[model samples]
Target: MIAKWIKFQILDTERQDWTRGYDTARRYFDREGSLDVPYEHIENAYPLGRWLSDQRRAFRAGTMSSTRADELEELGMVWDTADTAFAENLAAARAYYAQAGTLAAPRHATALDKPVGQWLTNLRRPNGLGKDPERTARRAEQLAAIDPDWNPGQLGWTVDWQRHYTGLTALLEAGGTLDGITPGVTYRGDDIGRWLARQARDWTRPNPEQQRRLGKVGVKPAARPQKTAARTNTKARAAKGSDAFTRGVTALAQYIQREKKTVVGRHHVEELPDGTSVRLGVFLSNQKSRRDRLTEQQLAALAELGYHWTQ
Candidate 1:
């Protein structure tokens, strides 16, 4: 099921060209098994079909030359006959190319406008084939010297292969081995893996909010209670009030002109006997550190004092 899913994923992914699709499909089939899975289970079948149809439309739109159209047509025919096996499909495509009488034709031009033929010919050298290890080392050493922090795994292997192949010719033209051979450094897979692991850790490490969410999911950390700024400020204010309660109360009374009205709570305003209005909250007290209820006498006294008593 996983293999089938992966196959569908590969098929659905947008490749640069048919050649890239062929290469990727080959790799997938080699890693996974033959793609004989049910087509109905592939969610992107219609999308893939649409993409192929678009390619065919582009081919027929006179954008491609007659020769290019022929090549594309041959490729299409191979695909039509190909089974789910990517290697088999690639082989069939190659066979079609070989038989088309234009197998060696250049597909595109490079930055220098050099034909693909020239590029391919220049870059088709076998890996690890040089006489001197020091000479072979020069290319790798140069790459490392230029980028000390380059991850070998993540670095474009395709570009590196081209460089390694083409650089040999360049190195030879510049006067051979003794020109300047830096010692070759072979980076361990483990070191690159560790660097990748560190990168993954750095990228995915949670901020405080994410950590809290993770904690809710049963991931334990230091178990310290998160102290918010508002909570801290409130506690500090409460502590300050408790420490200087009498002075604070006195100051408040002074601020209100010292004419105490009928006592209620901290937020209630009432009229005083001196014709100056004062809040009834000035003499309010907390009973048992909980809400205090007003007695009938107290209520009557407040009402008689022209204070609006809200139930």
Candidate 2:
């Protein structure tokens, strides 16, 4: 309910060194509204500054005092540090914050922090707000403002689309470059984001990766992979409604029926009469997987599948 954070709006400029302190405070809060800056950065001359910094991080990390927390409640945050869920999230936030590199935070602050939006999401999810799509949309907009050319998977930590953006934020704060991360994890934000905007977004393809998460409960991935669709369409278009596709389809179908043997992954890439190439059951190419647009597997797996594509 407090917009512009009532405290930041009114600073005590009469104090010496107030300008630099306020600027630093304002900048820190402006991005994520969390405190927990290293104690060294605190302008000890102003106790108010230090308190403000601590309070924000405490709130973001779910370590707030009861009285201060009540204020957040009044703002309709559904906040609660006592909940195990909140504790788990706070723990994760602290870990991420501690690893954060060179990013500004209150000097001597020990607790790692979560971005304010992330903090709110953790707070809200336990309250049944359903992870707030609008919040993610806003975050994407913010990320776009940060880097228009951002490609997902620059960090190569996970396949989750949300992680792509979250990792981007962390990398920026750490002052790390894309080159520092594992390779081949990018998608046009425009495409990948919409893919994430849908429900069941955190997904792993079972046939591709044999992920157990989808079947663990009654959940499926948020979206069918865009890569899957593109790969399929490319094959179809390359087929061009020609008899070759019919023949290939018929042959592949017969191979399955006759072999009654399972090939772990796609066995081959067929260059149809058309310019487009058709991967037996996927878009993967032994020579082309792990290139951001597509995912590949171990060399042993590729070798087992046997290559069939011709130039």
Candidate 3:
């Protein structure tokens, strides 16, 4: 019994867990040309990926032997995959900004074969950069360096609005005139004339900063001519009401995207891209109270905003 016990101990010592894991990792590295294994990857029924993750955790905790860490490092092991991913995404963002002249891409947009627009949208969300405050600030600064207006939410504007504004800025700089930019005219596929008209029509809605920007670009509030003023009042009122509803829907959509929730606070005010603030909480409350009064089109619009109500 003593001799058999001694033989078992000798066999166990010859097959240490770390030694076996290292051998599998080395074989994987040789075959895949990389050590960036997925967490659930298995090789020859051995959990090579989990084993590598264990090694990384040990290294981070200062429990790994220097020899073992060095061996894994030699095989191109990525110590911090998050940092590596950020670097790659940043590169893609840079490429997008270079071509678009603005980083205000649609959520479905792509660049450099990367989903850079969605990445940017995610990063713009609260705590999107990271949980570490200092690290988040540093990363935000890096993105700011690429495009100071990358996150236009703080500027009280949507990405779509920013994109159109960028095109307008470029056009004006190149000697385009407001008069020549009629309704059918476009800039970078955006109807600049229609956008400009909206800005003028809703001139009182825009905040001071927006007003100043528009003023600098020679845009002013649309003047109401006295000749047909009485005749246009009713028509104007109907049009303005429609516009207000559209703005409210826009504000609600943006709120849902940023907050990732539909339950807005009672006093929650959503700022539209045109700088108008919608009292979303009150708006919703009023809408729900008069749910039966909503027209078919209005009901569909609210449903599209994910505000499905039983009536």
Listed in order, each prediction's TM-score against the native is: 0.14, 0.24, 0.53
Candidate 1 lDDT at 186 equals: 17
Off by over 4 Å in 1: 1-15, 22-47, 66-68, 76-311
TM-score, model 3 to reference: 0.53
lDDT of 1 by residue, 1-311 (tens): 99888766774554345555334334434554532222112222332323343444555565545774564444432232212222222232233234322212222422222343333222223222134566445434433343332221222122222223233333444565421323341121112223222222333333444344334433333334576777988878766645443343333345444544333458765443446554435443332132123322233222223232211
Candidate 3 lDDT, 1-311, residue by residue in tens: 98888777875664487788888888988988988665546788988767777776787789877887788888888788475567667877888888778888767778768999889877866567899988788788888998998876666545665777777777788899988766767876778888788778767656666678888888889986566667688978868877877787788889988988879999999987777799999888887888665543565566545554511
In model 1, state the lDDT of residue 195: 25
For every candidate in turn, the CA RMSD to the true structure comes to 31.0, 19.2, 12.6
What is residue 182's positional error in candidate 1, in angstroms? 87
Error of 1 at 242 (Å): 99
Q: List the residue pairs that clash in candidate 3.
A: none
lDDT of 3 at 28: 88
- For model 2, how does the per-residue alpha-carbon lDDT over 1-311 read when each residue is reduced to its tens digit? 37545545553332234445545555555564554333234343554334444445667786656775664344333333233233333443434344432112122223434353335322222222235577545434433343332212222222233333344445444565433433433332223234323324434322332233223323346445346555888767655644443444444444445565434256665454556555555534334353333222222222222222210
Higher-lDDT candidate among 1 and 2? 2
